[model samples]
Target: MSSTTQKHRNFVAEPMGEKPVTDLAGIADVLGKRLVSHGFDRAYIVLGQFLVLKKDKELFVGWLQDLIHCNVMQASNCWQCLNDWCSEFL
Candidate 1:
């Protein structure tokens, strides 16, 4: 089985609380800072948008690509992270 990174595991392992978007796997400092500037400083805020998009993978991925220039892998990872978090918490 493919193993998840420690960051990914840690993020999905509990409540997001106020963790920043940068805290998610594949979201580097530069991207994180940019997201914050765009009003997505917190992980939950991003999650809000994910839900707002009706959890549509295409929309979420496209939004990530447009907002942060994230590649498919990066966008998918972040999307899965939030998706799993919602499954557990929301």
Candidate 2:
């Protein structure tokens, strides 16, 4: 499968703990830096945003684009990662 798929699986398979935002699928170093600069340094922090958005894909995807100017594919990957993680853990 694709690298993003692997990333999604790996992210969803474990407790997020203090994993850096970069560990999340589609959050590359540059995007992760942007997110960290905006106070979303950890995966769990991003997850919090996902939860705050009520896990609505549109809102979360729009928020990511608005916040960091990420493309739809990246934001979608991140949303899917969080969704799967929630399904497995919460």
Candidate 3:
């Protein structure tokens, strides 16, 4: 039952070299801005956090939620986006 958005499709389609954090699925302007303010201004920085969390769904989702009050769906979408990106590029 898992699925993704066009955002997700576009993200995982290629190497995410130096892309903005907003380019990740579910990380729109507000979230991206917050992430940027926290010094996680890039996709690779967020990806590093993802790896630091060992790609664990619950941990990553909780981190996103705690960081910028993102909801479950948003966090999950971002997680899946990163996970899929890793599958292709990492």
Candidate 4:
């Protein structure tokens, strides 16, 4: 079994429901603050971007990397979190 982070599991286990960007996996306080400052205060906003990117991993990862300067692993984690959420909820 893959060793998923608790954060990832928690976020994917339920509806996003206006959760803060920080609630997403791999988005810690610093990154969350950066996202908020850039007008991505909510998880849905990021999900909107992900959908707009057509759910392409590269595009979504690149967008997050560009927007927040997150490392590849961090971006990938966020991508996986959103992807799993979509799989369950959308």
Q: What tens-digit string does per-residue lDDT give for candidate 4 at 55-76?
A: 9999999999999999999999
Candidate 1 whole-model C-alpha lDDT, 0 to 1: 0.86
**TM-score against native, each model:** 0.91, 0.94, 0.95, 0.95
Candidate 3 versus truth, CA RMSD in Å, comes to: 1.2
Please write out the lDDT profile of model 2 over residues 2-86, one tens digit for every residue.
3557778888889989999999998999999999999999999999999999999999999999999999999999998998889
lDDT of 3: 0.93
What candidate 1 gets wrong by more than 4 Å, as runs, is: none
Please report how far candidate 4 places residue 44 from its true position, in Å: 0.6
The segments of candidate 4 whose C-alpha lies over 4 angstroms from its true place after superposition are: none
Per-residue lDDT of model 1, residues 12-31, tens digit only? 89999989888887788988
Tens-digit lDDT track of model 3 for 1-90: 157789899999999889999999999999999999899999999999999999999999999999988899999999999999998887
Backbone clash total, candidate 1? 0
Per-model tally of clashing residue pairs:
0, 0, 0, 0
- Once model 1 is optimally superposed onto the true structure by TM-score, how far is the C-alpha of residue 15 displaced, in angstroms? 0.6
Question: Which is the better candidate, 2 or 3, if ranked by TM-score?
Answer: 3
Predicted structure 2: lDDT: 0.92
Error of 3 at 42 (Å): 0.6
